[model samples]
Target: MQATLMIYDGTAAPDSEIPRTGGVPLAPEGFIWPLCGDCCGGPMQFFAHLPVEYGVLSVFLCQNNPGSCESWDATAGANRVFLFPPAGLVAVAVPESGVTLLPAVSAIKTQVVTLEPETGDDDELPPDAYDLARSGWEREPGEWFGKQREVLGSLGGSPSYLEDDRLPGCPSCSGTTEFAAHLEEGIDRQTAMNLGGQLGYVFVCRPCSEGAFLTD
Candidate 1:
């Protein structure tokens, strides 16, 4: 299988139009920063700004009182994902209170890697291709361990290890949402968006211009 990995490039301007994590989000005029509805009832932390085939996927998760909120649940109000149009986007105004942004703006670049299918007994569960590709990212021989820090996540691939029942339906049309991207905390924990050390999943409904966020 072929997987497109999102490799960490370096620091970037917070409002730059690019694939990145932990930057201020770019949105259309009159956009309101989302508030966490599950717990703490504060502004959600901006997690990523990804440009996709249909539009830009802007993700957010609750950081204040993290464990108390269900940010990992797609239907929960603690986390949010938005599919915004490609043009006429400007940096959103930051909220004065609550955890609303990450400490760093990390940029991303893509690398396509070919994965070999796992050869296992028929009774065994199939391996997650995206996980295999991510665990296998290496800058050089014997550097796999260290190089993994540069892997932010991936785009346009099936949700890794995600169950069929967990797939989110479009909130508007009740149609199945397509897997959009995978999100990692980041290279530095201090600047990373907390996911309870788990992987994050993004889903979208292009026709409805809506999206969902969850973690596992």
Candidate 2:
């Protein structure tokens, strides 16, 4: 039988997967956010937009909450929402319940990032696994932040989704992680830095915290 939803390389999902909730900005607005991914009561704000080859990702975090509920989940239509752990991955939702782990549509990413009147029918990426896990299959590094959905995808003609405010664990290890920029003025020179202090409440792994440079 054909799967109801088709998961892309855990990256691109169909346009239909995006939640069409009105009155909601691309990001959650004025949300008191009493619960973090770990269910901690705190304020989670708009973080960042991860522009992948397939879609624009949105990630959120709450420093106040330990790892209790720093996760994110939204329903656009009949499809469930989630985020892939690897750099590029996407997947479609399947039948699931309290104890049953649902299966996914696709696994690898087509690395396709274009949705217009045309070019929509051109490219596609097979479901790419970051690693492998139980259920229909999962990316590697099993210990994922329970706060966020394991994987999510974007299909043509669907609202885009992505990873945002991703806390940098070790840029040296992860390569390039996005950060809020800050400009510092010196008598003879100016310097650009990563915002860490005031923005500390944002997203940054434990190590990145040591190398953070606050913004103005």
Candidate 3:
């Protein structure tokens, strides 16, 4: 029997000029660490380095004392997102004190099983660009994922409307939340946050600085 190659889930070590996930964030030369406001007094975890047609988007998450830190609130100092030009790249300076970063980051490497799954063999559609890119990583993990890197915006396709029963309430205000960001696994396995084969969804309560993450 052939051994299956499974997806990877953890912070990645990236080479220069290549955008990656789970490694040190690329920031301005004089960039200062983002301090949390939820009384945790710590630096956020570097989650992703997204390079788009215009600029790069850096994402961070704060889960220090998740029980009381209110990291879910976008306004509670739980997470931060930064956008800037790639020309101004610099490694973030880690602070001597406070929570500097998360111990681990989610990563994934997908193996192609079937394009649309073998559903009764009625009709066959070739795999789309997103699906092929994800599978292509198995051939050349070092190659840059052009458009796939930006799939987080619309999840490479339309997002399903999640029902209220499946959604989570805001941790801070307990109000209904709205979809904020689609957290897809990054260009490589190290930056991929596996959600049981589903894309990750982020919802936020802007007024309370609270947010929620779940698989859709």
Query: Cα lDDT of all candidates, in order?
Result: 0.88, 0.25, 0.52
RMSD (Cα, Å) for all candidates, in order, is 1.7, 20.5, 9.6
Candidate 1 lDDT by residue in tens digits, 32-88: 999987867899999999998779999998988878889999887898888999999
On the 0 to 100 scale, the lDDT of residue 66 in model 1 is 71
The TM-score between candidate 3 and the true structure equals 0.50
Cα shift from native, residue 171, model 2 (Å): 20
> Model 3, range 1-216, lDDT digits (tens) per residue?
111112443335542344445656777788877766677777765665555444565666664554566544445566665656768688776777655544444343333222333244547653343344344433544765433453333321322445557666675667876654455554455344333345655565556643455555
Estimate candidate 1's alpha-carbon lDDT, on a 0 to 1 scale: 0.88
Best candidate, TM-score: 1
What stretches of model 3 exceed 4 Å from their correct place?
1-16, 102-181, 184-216
Q: Rank the candidates by lDDT, best first.
A: 1, 3, 2
Clashes of each: 0, 43, 11
> Which residue pairs clash in candidate 1?
none
Candidate 2 per-residue lDDT, tens place, 127-211, comes to 2222111113233347543311222322222111123343333323443333322111111111101122221211222233211
